[model samples]
Target: MRLMALFAAFSLSVSAQSVTRAGLTVTYRDPADRGQLARVFTVWQKAAQDLKAKGLTLPPATLTASRNASDFASLTGYPAHIAAITLKGNIYTQRLAALHARNLLPYTLRHEAFNLAQPPDLPRWLAEGLARVFSGEAQKDPPERTGLETLSERELDTLLARASGLGLNRVYREATRRAAQRLKQQGWQETLTLTSR
Candidate 1:
């Protein structure tokens, strides 16, 4: 079925159930998810520390997980192919088990945390690019050629906001490359202060 049709077919809501450990709070609805927060708190800690060192200190944020992909897609209004999203300083994700099975749990945690903590006025393309770079996903991108560079910042942001699945991946890699280059040219603090008005 089509992605929008699939998203429109069902709707589910998240209930507030939470666990706090080592300065991190995780929210989830599944009974099976108990104790899983403890397992990943370290990743959050590391990402927080690393981002802080890079001049972006995060605020109080909760990492939330939906029990299944359908619920996640419905709640987030994003394609399930998208790993996670940050809204109002909270991270919402698909099932922890699914992310673990796919080895995306750590990267997702890091990436979304950056999104949560990023400067409020940061441009979308730069925000996404630096998020992946901060999460180390940028380093792992498979080399591929694309026309993304020719697009203006506004155009790139629009693409990043609308694309899903592989289309999202390509734009994301280009964004990462752009962000990394900018970071290299201007130091981290300078970049944040200059671009993140």
Candidate 2:
């Protein structure tokens, strides 16, 4: 039991290197990625401002930039602990890279940060949609619309039929649309408050 406990402690220490900046903490394996870390800090700063504007409390956030796909999958296992984890190279990396090229990294970062702030019980649609909304990507482009608005009736039906096989992208789009509609009807503060329950 002592050996196992020691191993667990050592493993946790080796898994991540962290830095705190502007009230945001970032964890990663490579210390050389300081530039990327600063970028994440900027995103968090913007997100904090937006949340403050909405009169919402800013939850403590720790952004983790996973070294690779495997790391991302592992780090995200306990979603409640961290605010967000960005994979170095994965299926979505190509698309995310394009967004970065367009200087929209902050938007993506903000989206993930919003995910980190909310309770786990929050509905997928509301969580993802609010992320897009907070990130300022809700009205930007179709790719950014990861909520119900992006799906057609037929596609929605198919997704419903194969709920177990539903993709994360589809969830984001559907949630974005649903969240937008709710925001329109209920307003921001109430929408955020709903997540608590």
Question: Quick one: best lDDT, which candidate?
Answer: 1
Top TM-score model: 1
TM-score for each model: 0.86, 0.62
> Model 1, range 73-152, lDDT digits (tens) per residue?
89888777667898766688988777877888888988987887788888989888888988888878987776688998
lDDT of 2 at 91: 16
**Per-candidate local distance difference test:** 0.80, 0.61
Q: Which residue pairs clash in candidate 1?
A: none
- Give the alpha carbon lDDT tens digit for every residue of 96-147 in model 2: 2333556766776777666666555665556667878888877764755444
| Model 2 residue 59 distance off true place after TM-score fit, in angstroms | 2.2
